[model samples]
Target: MPVELTIHQPSEIFLNDAAVKVKAESPAGCFTLLPRHIDMATALVPGILSYETPEGREVFVALIGGILVKQGNSVTVATQMAVEGPLGDLKNAVDVMIREEDDRDRKTRAAVARLEADFVRRFMEFRKNA
Candidate 1:
């Protein structure tokens, strides 16, 4: 019996496939799951998720931190982000995604800081006038 693997992201389903084996990284370390594996759940870290198809071909997906659950022959992964493709391509894609997220976060922080500074300045002016 093979295991059914499904990966979910907030916006879409990342992957749904039947896999002979699956490998993922967690806080404790990396682990592999096979059919009949014990039922458990773990906090997944940002890493590569690899699985073997029934035809014996291996596929890889880059995953951001998330939660993973294995129950019976079903494995479910809920992640914030994932990129799936050839291993080399997937690595590049993941790097780009990480950089983009970092840039967005930096911009958001800068905007918030500016807003805070403006609020403080306005408050000081009001206090002086009063």
Candidate 2:
């Protein structure tokens, strides 16, 4: 499937185009939803949202934000206030995300930490088992 996304930055309102949707994290969990999804919404938190364009996942840190995703055959993400990162650095990218979110509220910070930790734990567990 070839699905392209657009993320319109609030500050960059002059640019009225849907920017590419990157892999991202919500309060519920971390996922990469492509276009043509099932139409689901999630609570946005301060964390990292990554977008993998079939080729690979590009991780980015989202500052003070939330997004809604609905993925099935395809997906789309709508977010706010995001800071980008390198090509392949999910962990480092997420680490920065935790600290940045921590600058906001204890609750938001804690939530981001928990989510990031959960992702790490799961990835580790999967690798160990694999």
Which candidate should be chosen as best, given TM-score against the real structure?
A: 1
Residues 86-130, candidate 1: write the lDDT tens digits: 988887877877787788889999999999999999999999999
lDDT of 1 at 122: 100
- Runs of candidate 1 exceeding 4 Å displacement: 115-130
Model 2, 42-102: lDDT tens digits are 7666665555555554445444555554554334445555556564564565567667556
How well does each candidate superpose onto the true structure, as a TM-score?
A: 0.80, 0.46
Model 2 segments more than 4 A misplaced: 13-22, 57-61, 69-78, 87-130
Best model per lDDT: 1
